[model samples]
Target: MATKPDIVTLEALDAFDALIDARSPSEYAEDHLPGAVSCPVLDDDQRRLVGTLYKQRGPFEARRIGGVWVARNIARHVEAWMQDKPAHWRPLVYCWRGGQRSGSFVLWLRQIGWAAAQLQGGYKAYRRWVVQQLAELPPRLAWRVLAGPTGSGKTRLLHALAAAGAQVLDLEGLARHRGSILGAWPDGQPQPSQKAFDTALVAALRRLDPARPVWVEAESRKIGLVQLPEALHQALQQAPRVQLQVPFEARLALVLQDYAWLGRDPQALARRLQALRGLQPGEVLQRWQVWARQGRLPELFADLMTRHYDPLYQRHLRADDARATMLVLPGLDEATLAQAAAQLLAGGLARVGS
Candidate 1:
């Protein structure tokens, strides 16, 4: 008979070679541990059916039926997914709350001579730790907030900073968004669930060194659909600010390049721009839509920036007066941003917390 399956806590997460999330596919899709592979003991349909049976029939009846399905599914996983896993391979397994699904999977693997273990409290425990870390981690690190108007290439510059070996927290990247009214990725890519975003944000923070200041983009509390934790928002609000000043022509060019996909579907682009209807005059919106249909990108973007984005950004700039140190760049070219990144790293901004 197999011995009681080993149970590991969140603190010992790194000890395992692989993480197997044994929850249903839908549950796994909503959120799972970073780098975890989904190995559900019950799929979505089976889980729903089991839940219905539990409610309509009774707990005992539901378990009697669910057990056979769960066992067969686990067997299938062992044959198909575990075919190549060596006898010495170790995997950390977890379901919703370290319950029967994961426990049974671990027992089977352990009996096969693999050193498999179940998380003490499963994904639920990891999620709680994520929430706690999101609250605790940001305040401990020194942050350099890069502030700029839309189209100023803040994200691009952040990428350059990372390439230049600076510590950078890319909140937009974590959210899988550009953080704008038109932020959704091209081809309709969806953002991760809020739980998943928190998981990624906490994992990113854990990888950084507190000794070095982390450079991050200035943002509102919300990025696309994900909300920044209160502590992180407060930390960013209180952090040192570095403002980017790129000429309007350069900013326009940067925006057009970044949002080139907008030109392909004029009707869709026009509909998206309608989010600014109240901010822009009706006639101006109509004209912009016309330009969009005509594929007149330069006119469309220039007018959008001057009439919509710039005015809003000016108000924000006024509020931020006396708080930001300016870093003026003639353009947002790769070479230019790379040079600016090097200057910041080799000079003043790099000296802030050092």
Candidate 2:
């Protein structure tokens, strides 16, 4: 007699040797549990074909056809992917809603003498857990918001703090955006889907100790296309802030270094600047584009800082950060930022958290 496969909930996930996502490749690509390996029981096309058959020919015909395809795929996986598994290997498998794909896979693995289990409610259950934890976790931990104008190197400082052994949550880093209109990564890496971002965020949060204050950059509710969960955004807003004050020239130099790709691909920079078109006068916008086309980046960057970014910062960011503890830095070089980070870890920023 075959041993019955176990069904496990979210809490039991870590006990397994491997996490297998049995959903289609496309579904796995969109979002999945952190550290899950894609071992789809049905390929994207196969899943589509099976669903269409179910709709057109009724459940009986669909199952008859689908079972053959599923059996062949499972055998292929066992041969190609699981051949090296030891006798005692245990794996957790999940599909969209703890349904047929994962159930069948777990059944086969159990018959083969491995301890395999299906996720109780599959990816949907994991997603719900992510949402609930995100809603609840941010409130319990203390947040330290880093408030600074554009080009002030908030992200760099976050890195510096992390290197100095401080608890840091770089939301923009996780979102794959810099939290600005021009914030798309220069390397052309696409941002993760909102679901993926949430997964990454929660995983990062889970790693941190709640007893320590988490330092995060002050950001708008949305970072590129991903919105911070409401609880987190609220916690960040309510947290004490550390204001960074850098001189205009230092900021300009930092921007030039950070966005050096803008200088190399001025046309790309010109196109991105178009996002600010409605806000800036047509002539001003036209001139900026012309400067971009001409490769006159320093002048274009300075104008953008003085005219566009500065005004917006004054109007928006300055209000709530009025009482913030100010750290006036002379430069944004790595050594300088590292020194500042060290001081912060030395309890320079403790009062604000308190």
Candidate 3:
């Protein structure tokens, strides 16, 4: 007699053939197991109606209605699974918890002579593991901070370093913000919640060897609206920094290149620039607004860099005593910038003197 495979434990989940999330679409969308695919057992409308029935009627009546829906959904998934399943496929199915939903699916799979396992404690268990990993990251690894002034191309440099085979963590990229007042992208996507941020950071760290250097951008504790995990923030504070420098004109050009989309909505650009009000004095703010209206974008950006951005950067530099490594780019051309980044990262440049 053949025996069925039991449900998977958290540690063994990564090796599972497939991770089927059997929660409703809405439930799945709210948050889910990191790599699980949605093969919902109940659609959103059906799930809501069942919930209402369960509250309004007796448990038996609710279960009877739910059972019909669940069986239909399971049959569809099973057919799909059969088409996709390989001979060696050993699926791990789960729902909100290792409850009736997953149990029913697992039983059906077993009856059909397919080897499928449920996830013990389901998605909730995975969330717990993610939280634990992130909360304890500081004690497990050392980080290297890559700090730079505004428009210094830190994010782009991080990507360049990654292409050169260095381990890099792009914090702003993950947060979906460029880390400035005008940094929001056209999509206006909000960053993931702090819990979600920690989950992602921990996952990135897991891929790297802790003994090796990992590069991350120098940033404030908050990137736009998302606050960094405290443990990782503390690790960043202690990490040694490699500072980058570019000529003011080059930086201005880089800023323009970064925000090239702004050319289409000069009014929106003006508004975003105006958002910096009260941070600077009224006269300085008005002057910048005039430059913006006159369409002197380069001059406007230069003024902001000198009067607002650079001063804030200087303060952080004084506090950190960062080891500034100057890699001067001749121009903002992609090739020139990439070459300059490569030279610095490849240890081809002399160390900058204070």
Best by TM-score: 2
Badly placed stretches (over 4 Å) of model 2 are: 1-5, 349-354
- Cα deviation of 350, candidate 3, in Å: 5.3
Clashes of 1: 0
By lDDT: ranked, best first: 2, 1, 3
Error of 3 at 232 (Å): 0.9
RMSD, one per candidate, in order: 3.5, 3.2, 3.8
- Candidate 2 per-residue lDDT, tens place, 1-354, comes to 543449878888889999999999999999999889998888999888889999999989888988988888889889987999999999999999999999999999999999999998999999999999999999999898888889998989899999988999999889998888878877788999999999999999998898999999999999999999999998998998888888899899888887787677878878988999799999999999999999988899899989988888788874667788888788888888998888777767422211
Q: For every model shown, what is its TM-score relative to the native structure? A: 0.93, 0.94, 0.84
Write candidate 3's Cα lDDT for 176-254 as tens digits. Answer: 8888887886555777766566667777778878787788888888888778777888888877667776678778888
- Model 1 lDDT tens row, 1-354: 543449978877888889999999999999999899988889999999999999999999889999999899989988887889887789999999999989999998888989999998888888889999999999999999888898888999899999999999999989988888888888888999999999989989999999998999988889999999999999999898888888898999988888999888988888888888887889998999899888899999898888877787778664655667878888888888888888888765422212
Clashes of 2: 0
Ranking by TM-score: 2, 1, 3
- Find the 10 residues in a row with the least total lDDT in model 2: 345-354
